[model samples]
Target: MASSATTGNPMPPSLSMPPSQFARLQPHAYLRAHLSPPSSDQPSVRANGRATSQFRVTSVNTGSLTHANGSAVVRIGDTTAVCGVRAELLHTSDISSWGVSQAPSKQNPTNTNEAKDSKSEDEDDQGQIQDLNLLVPNLSLSTGCAPGLTPGAPPSALAQSLSHQILSLLHTTNLVRADDLRIWYQPPNFDSEEFHNPGEGMEVDTEQSGGPEREIKAFWVLYIDIMILSMAGNAFDAAWASVLAALRDTKLPNAWWDDDNETILCSDDFAEAHRLTLRGLPIASSFCCFEGDAAAGWRANVIPDAEEQKKKKGSQQKWILADPDGYEEGLTQERACVVVDKENGKTIIVKMEKHGGWNVDSDDLRKLVDVSSQRWDDLKQALEQC
Candidate 1:
């Protein structure tokens, strides 16, 4: 071979790898290198250039769908989700388990205890909603939202799991009020003075008044559909945000039971529509614990005694990242979700879910709640703008 050194081709620029390629090939090591700096002077930062406890900015838009009773679009960083709520009337006659006894009949009893009995029957409003299956929520990922999500296939495990979580939160929080869904019918002259004061020189016939003066004839079933337009990461938070915004924007028409037709009817006046009265604005925040690679240069100490090992365990280098992106999610295994509601300037934890790793402890949970509270304020402000 000819002597190329003499020709001065000059070592063709020492080949270098890009940071993006390095992150893809060695995600764990790449993250560890950033979090565990070579010197104490260097600040620890994530590969995405976000602080460990910082979350992405959230933006929301509501009432985007005219056909849907309520609709909202939420974007958290690069991830985006659209939620739509449709209400359908479910007549009591259609429910096989519904019976006449469940409905309170008009009575002429002249005691306060009798009125208490009638009120007690309707106390379990949430129970009625659950028993009748009034709320239905479904989540689906778009085909191109992420890699490996193909079209025309059955729902993936992630989708199913997310849907289940959403449904569980909805039920646990009791966000929807049953009074907003219930449709009642009052017979003619039922609210007359005779009913208000039965013994005030007035006679009432139970047969003439038909059955119950006021009875629930139907309930509104809210079908909440959430679609992931783009899934960068932290799907649960984005999905929940969309759901909350959509429900806030949802309006149901004035509905009543028709006596002659014996069916639920909706009013045509737009002014008669009313928005849903949700219990509280609950917000969801997600985080992941990124444990440094075992073989990384940060952990070069020799194995110690049992007591020393126990002491060193607490000093392990791990980073708890808030609102991790897709790349960070793949590098981490430990994750947690905190759902919180703010009441009177106090943060109330509605639900807390932690799994996939044991690095998170009680103290860590408290920190997570603090971060969630801040995130809640940010998201709440965003929703309010819509």
Candidate 2:
């Protein structure tokens, strides 16, 4: 005791901190401690009581809205999204950019080769859905889902960016077929002799009275509106899952052009309605890379030489978290999302987006893709049930 006193070493009073308090005060340390067990005998787990590679439970329900053509609600963990698809008619005549005539006549016949080449060019130009803005996707995050979000205000940058991402994915995937949206009209064949020699050799305009002409008078424009009722994390995945489910459940009424009324009309019969044919199902999985360093975060404020401590650590640890919650999202800056689809007993990668960190390499990406495939199957099964 005398030697300890001389060395100025004194025993401090016993102290204890609650788990919730510790987590609130030192979130980075809390997560790191949970991920790293004190001994090898103990198993490492996440703060949410999940494994490193485990994903949240997903639920999908369709046809929830009576008025909408299609509707679905999807929940992933705490995140919930509701999607409604409303179809409106858009007349081709109203489109100023569409210069091509819908009906071709015998006298002013269109060149077959030129028409074929034009069709090819249009296909190469990424289809008419983009040109005509047929599919409109609106994602709203201002539903009081999370803190710091004000309702009824203009859309934030995050919401707009997510909306654009959804729209781009819809276009790139070619999920919706154009043929289903067309309202075609077969004009009466006026090529008969009675019509040609009507009223004592009156001049007949072949262009106006085209023979066996089929024209697209109008198109069904689908407006996909998605609302995030509750947001925990991974909002994109939830919103997209809702969209897929809603589109699958959507059934457009049979519509045709009315020549006498000079307008479009839809059948009231439910049997005549048809569902949109979507391409292969694509699912996205997101992962965040948590750098396993406690001192590099808030401790840097107290520890002036945190950089030196990080250097001395000799390569900081990293933990890849799958389907991170809101708390984990704030702790991690690096994120990667992999979109995958399965066809013909094979997994196909649709899209990959990675940013905010470079620790995730090709091998990590391949693993993420595998995870996405599993997620795709899970979502597919859920959608099939609806």
Candidate 3:
């Protein structure tokens, strides 16, 4: 084939873009614009024809940041999140003391905290174990991402909830088990080390309090931050990727106990680290609700725009976009995110976000789970590099 350009790059036949397509070209939203659903009259084709049960091109990059302990960015066909982990020193111990449900005598009866602190241990709290899991997700929308709009300086409400959900999930699930954190919950004594900051090495107590400072004890505090550079279908996958990478890159200062004349018995240094056991490398997948003729039948793989945005009782909105684009998301019928675990071959329903539900039968659910197992493998391969 004759080369269009001297290099691998193809020469542009036409430089102009249509108004509707060009209007949606924010930096982050560009992916959305490209993946937007096809017109009702035209058949839709995603990048490489990824069916509803399939995923698009995915890749993982690591060590993207140096100052942090561990860091990686996972790109699931353009939805990307960069995660960095920094270990600080903290006095952490686990002691379970039963608490009496006592309200501050003057506290408002409707205080939400009272309900939150109280434990129910339900699916909503899935993955959370009594541990110190701190996750911060930074989402900055950029007009620089899309073409015409002025990007907001701060995260929108949707972005805030994402950070809160990830942080809560990381702790509740025991993803980073607290027991593994080394210290048990206890009162800080002069002998115990304080939490280290981002720049500092592991916390170690020097013998400055009294006589010859004999003991050197340290606590490793971890700060995990994930930044969402773009938004597409799968946010959870990117979040998990960031978490895994950050831990792998993390490094702690060396610690040793020394006495007069005795050779060093043991030491923990930057080389040694605690990586998540990774008991199971399960992943989440989603399917946008689609409804074609049950009698006439459409391909189960493709989603169409039913446009079922927030229907009240008795509303007859029937159509929606499967794997909805950003604009069609609000109008989606039903969105189900399923998580599949390699261990024990178990698949759990993580969440459901949609109005009208479809294809809830066991066969469909089981098929989705089966598909997830195969689909999640690529993510696992990417995480392995960390």
Candidate 4:
């Protein structure tokens, strides 16, 4: 008979699990054990060693990419995002021609007449269809950004969802004005003597001659693209920050209609460029809910009943954590993101999103808002410095 050691009995090794599995199993406990301070007097810390309700250090850099009209790179803790803006000339006539045509003038008419009216309506509708997409936004996430993302494949659901959210915010917040993008056309100077004998070696000096009433012939379209370089957590916040920085740094060049070429001409002079007028700086903050024993310390502070607490000690306890990372995020059951813009000395909640099954109390929500307001101030100052 072989000895016990040589019997080939497989024994479960001490710490024989993958790092990901280790992170998944009792994630909160792992954080509290490794990240929190040994002293009981100190509060429990997150995986990144940040106190509860505190965000990680954030940084931003603007106008870094020369190819893009505007560009910015934002880093919040481990999450990083880059945003770029490209400007393209779009004719106003084309956009206005896309609107829906008016209904037929006559409700009831002969078949031939109705057919004629339908054809006319079709033509009018085609002429009236307006292109409402003035600002286009897209987000890209690839394999290197995170673990599950694949390379060169279709964008994941998370990327598509983030893109939609950004589009919604840009449209609803009124961040960019329509008039700022308009390019006015300087009409020809028919009164000038140069127009009398145009074929006889006479050239029309359009730049020097005072023309008729000017009208908007075209507008500049801004295409905003965001790429996620790294995603630890809170991608929405990082993406929004990058967009704000890039847009703030954008400058549109002076554009004019060229009647001779039948195209819009943009001035090469840098001095002729104009900056966008932003309504206000908007910032976002995100939070996650940590339930069970992970929140015992917080629950103790909130509920000051020794006997009641003892009775419910075995019950689940809940706490809110700000700026959670990937490991903590996996264990969290609920999340909330709030966007605030300061306007005229008052804080406005421009957008708010909540997900997951956990229900937050009114008091807890109020606390989250206060934290978000503070975070907005921090982010706004950082952006200004950039």
What are the models' TM-scores? 0.85, 0.82, 0.55, 0.73
Ranking, TM-score, top scorer first: 1, 2, 4, 3
Greater lDDT among 1 and 4 belongs to 1
How do the residues 310-367 of candidate 3 rate in per-residue lDDT, one tens digit apiece?
Answer: 1223343233222334444432446565555564655544432323455454566666
lDDT of 3 at 149: 34
* TM value for model 1: 0.85
In model 2, where is the ten-residue run with the lowest total lDDT? Answer: 101-110
lDDT of 3: 0.49
Candidate 1 whole-model C-alpha lDDT, 0 to 1: 0.84
Best candidate (score: lDDT): 1
lDDT of 1 by residue, 223-334 (tens): 9999999999999999999999999999999998889988888998989999998988999999998876544222334534533564566656788999999988987878
Candidate 1, residue 142: Cα displacement in angstroms equals 0.8
lDDT of 2 by residue, 1-386 (tens): 47766888887765988899999999998999899988889777999999888889999999899999999999999999999999999998899865562324421235534443534543633466787888999999855899988757788887899899999988877778777787888676567555757767566444455456466688889999999999999898899999999999999999888899999988999999999877789888889999886445566678798768767877888888999999899899889998888999799988899998666889999988888888788778888987
TM-score of decoy 4: 0.73
**How displaced is residue 219 in candidate 3, in Å?**
5.2
Instruction: State how far residue 294 of model 3 sits from its true place (Å).
Output: 16
lDDT-better candidate, 1 vs 3: 1
TM-score of 2: 0.82
